[model samples]
Every structure is written in structure tokens, then in C-alpha cells.
Target: MALLHRAELRPSKLELLVPWLPGRPWFAGEAGAEVTRVAAYRFDDPAGEVGVETLLVRAGDGPVLQVPLTYRGAPLAGADEHLVGVIEHSVLGRRWAYDACGDPVYPPLLAAAVLADAGQAEEYFEVDGKREMRPASMTLTGSRTGRPVPTGPVSAGPVDSGGTVVRVGEVELAVVRQPVPADVPPAGGLTGTWPGQDEPVLLAYAR
Candidate 1:
């Protein structure tokens, strides 16, 4: 389960992504186009220290883009290159967000989700010391049967229009940074759907 806080974020997520997305080789939008968040999902960290979430955004009429992000109380050691930017949290003070592809926590948890056919984590908000369910903005599903891959440090390769390959332990996972066209081959791993979408959209796959 993931806890949701009713906190304010300075330079909200959309603000951060607007500038960051265009720099990514896989980003399909115009460099300075307006970006809007379409949907989002999350994964729970067993230790409850890191915040794991993936956002699907669209720029104008462009295809939806998948961007996974990790939030930490402090900078992740050895991952300066992946830092998206720092944000001031109303309740937590400050947070450092990084590209999930470069954060060590994301790959293994994603691998476990794919191999175990797990759905996105359940979210709850604290109210008077009691937890109440908070509906997620997106629905995510993983494949039911796949070989369990050990999770480990992730090394991200150069991203291109096609996608990027990251080595997670001994497993190689391919993240589809851009939306897959209708004629494209079916995704082989986790998928998601949002309001008004009847079909599951590919998020990532194990290679």
C-alpha cells in the first residue's frame, strides 16, 4: 500500500516534466509544446522510504508519453545524472525526484510486479490517524506468468525513438518511452489504462 499525503508541491510535477520531457530522445512532442498529465500509477516501496510513480502525459495532439519518477528525501547517491529537479513539499520540506530508469529502486520492484502479475499499489490517505482509501487515477496490470527475474542495480543505456534498454540484475527490460501504435506488436509485460480508455496501453516489457 502507498500512503497519499494532502500536501502542496512547489513547481508541481507537470511543471517539472514540461522542461524535462523535450530533452529526452524518446519524447515525441514539440520542444516547447504544452504538456498535460493524462494519468498516473504507483508502486509501493517495502521500506516506505522512496516514492515510486509513473505519469502518462500528452503534449497537444501528440502521442502519450510514459515517464516514471522516483522521489527521495535526499539525493540518490551516484544518480546525479538522472535527477529531474528538486521540489519543495508542503509537508515533507524538500524532495529530489529522479528518472525511474536510473533509480535503483524502480527496476526490481517493476520486475517483481511483472513476474508476479501484480497490480499497482493501493493508496490511502491519513485522516485523524486513520487511513482511508484513495482511488488511483490510473489502472495498471502485469503479466500473469513470467520467469521471476532477480532485481539489482539498474544501468540505463542511451534512449532512442524506439525505446531504452536497462539491465536489471541479469534481466534486460525495455521501456516504451513513446506510445505504441495500433499495428505494433503487443507489449510483453506491464500495461495500464486510464479513464475513457477501454484497452490497456503498453508501459514496459521484459526482454
Candidate 2:
């Protein structure tokens, strides 16, 4: 896996995030807040150019949060089955694939993403617990066609305190952001509860 830490994410990653950050649920900017990278990193699929990135952003009043992102060269061909929506990259002038929140890659990458933000071995280890999290099994059929769910394609699943979503094929695995009670220890050892771990509700993927 191509794991890129904060320093490696610079220039290139920053350029990608400039326009992408504002659209996120965690984005505090009502008028598109200015984003500065506090820390960042990336991981690449061993087989292909599909890459995932973990970014820590200092947006505004919100806690410095880790935002995990994935980059693909092109959209998955048969993704209509799991279609969520599209995110337009201002710099690239192209649209990209988004996937289900339960894409299986999230918890591990989320742990790695936490390490990218904390910048310490012990702090990084704290996220190891998250690596063990898996998506809850569901019995629902595909909403669009009411067909049995099929296996999805290569996907990017990003999880943070605000929420977590995975976009693959045409399905978006959405885990709504929930408020973490004062009793629970925060994920990633950041200031507050991480986005995905709180109360999660799945939303059908859309643009």
C-alpha cells in the first residue's frame, strides 16, 4: 500500500483539497471557509493507481479533524449499481467515483489517517481500535431496482467525526455523524469524537 504521510501530501494534495473541502459535512465554512493543511498522508492500492489519503484540516471553530479522501483515475464503469454521486474537481475539471461507507477499507485507513494527524507512534496506535470496526450487516435490497445487492468495485471510504461515507459503483454507504456522549473515549485521540463512530444513519447515495 502506498501510505503517504502529511509531508508527502503537500502541493499535490493541497491542490486537490482546495475545492473539495468545502462540500464536506464537516466543513464549518458557511461561505466556503479557507482550508489549510495541518497534516496529511496517502495510501495506494497495491495493484493499481487507486489511492487513498488522510487529511487533517484546520477549518475554523471546529476541532482539527482528519478527513480521509480517495483518488481514482476514472469512474468505475458499472457503478450505476452502487452510484452515490459525483464530486467535481475544479483543478482537474473532471468528475470522480464515490462509494459506499461500508467499503471495508475505511477502519484500517482511518487508523492510518489518525496517525497522519497525530504524528506520534503512541497517538497513532490509539486508532488501532478503529481498524477493527466493520460495517453492520444489513438485509435491505438495492433501492433503485429492488434487486439483491451485488458486490461493489474498488472504492474509497472516508471516515471522520462529522460522518463517514463510501462511494463505490453507484451505492453510497452512509454512516451519519452522531454526537458522542461525554463518557466515551474519542477515536484517533483527537479532541472530540471522530465522525463515523458516533450515531450513524445511512443515507442513500446522491449528488
Candidate 3:
């Protein structure tokens, strides 16, 4: 139940992206841009020590993108290449960080969130194309361990805006009434080969 503020979650590492945003195939920012964190918040993880944090970033000429991440203890042994930029904590007095996208714990947590947030009670759960969806009531309590176990299935969808084209998975399966964002084109959804993967899937249009 402990919530953290953007400033409280200091960056263990901060690297400037002079041209990173524009070149990203999924990024919507204008070419040759400079973006920064506009907001951030942490979520609980019931079974692990490190928690999940979502950083709301604002790229030049783009809408905010929610980069879901986790701060880890040891640098992920093989994920050195995916590091976004480490942050040195002024309060904890130690450098603590890691990317959950590269970590193993994110998929299930995401699946559970989609079900709980959407209020579906009969869906299943699985990871890495394992065909593992089960019926339960789960909630993503935090990025750290100790979350409640009421699990459900996750739906994927595209989240294009500004100049970026990122996918969001584990959305509630319930039929949505909301209009899809105008910036996100219809053809831009999750596309992968794995069955259990939470890749983005496009839904209703806003014509």
C-alpha cells in the first residue's frame, strides 16, 4: 500500500536521448527530439522484492507514454543492453534499478492487472505462449512481492499516440465502450508468434 512520488523515485541513471526518441520505430516523438519524465508511480508485486514502476514520459510533439518498469537489485545478468538509464537513489543511498520488460515477472503481473482492472472473473493466466489462462480474481498490488492472487486472462492492444507505436497487453476482455484514440491508427496492434505472449491487439475504431 506504499505509494511513491516521481521525485522520490530518483533515477539511478539518466542518459540524454538526443536522437533516440525519433529513431525508435515505435516512437511518435518528432525527429531530433529531447524528452523527459513528466510523471511516475510505483505498483506492488506480491511475490518479489523489487516493485513495478510506471514512468509517464513526455516526448517532444507527443502524448505521454507510460513506460512500465521495475527497479531490480542486481543488473539483470543478460539484459545490460536494454538498460534505459540507471538512477542513483539519493534517499536509499544506493544505486538500484533494472528493466522489468527484460525481467521474467512482468508478464504474469500484467495479465493479472488486466483481469482485475477489467473485473473479469473467469479468465485464465499463462506466460510465454504456454496456453496458461485460469479462472481467479487477481490484482496487481505493487511492483514488489506480496500481491493478492485473483488471476485472470489478459487481452493485448495497440497504444499509438503522438509519434510512438507501443503495444499494451492484459487489457480487460470486456467489450469497451470508449473510443480508440485518434492518433493510434487501426493497423497498429500487437503482432507476434507466441500464443501466451501479451502482444498488442487493435480494437474498435474512432471514425
What is the number of backbone collisions in each predicted candidate, taken in the order shown?
0, 25, 42
- Where in model 2 is the C-alpha error above 4 Å? 1-12, 60-62, 77-161, 165-207
lDDT of 1 by residue, 1-207 (tens): 998889999989888887888888888876777888888888888789999998889976788898889999999999998999999999988999999989888888887766666778898999999999988897767776656667666788667887777777887777788745332224347777778776877777777
Model 2 lDDT tens row, 101-153: 33344433333222223221111211434432222121111122232232356
Off by over 4 Å in 3: 3-23, 36-41, 118-207
Tell me the alpha-carbon RMSD of every candidate.
Answer: 2.1, 12.6, 13.6
Q: Cα deviation of 38 in candidate 2 (Å)? A: 1.0
Residue 63 accuracy (lDDT) in model 3: 54
Q: Of models 1 and 3, which has the larger TM-score?
A: 1
- When 2 and 3 are scored with lDDT, the better candidate is 2
Model 2 residue 49 distance off true place after TM-score fit, in angstroms:
2.6
Sort the candidates on lDDT, descending order: 1, 2, 3
The candidate, 1 or 3, that scores higher on lDDT is 1
Candidate 2 weakest lDDT stretch, 10 residues: 134-143
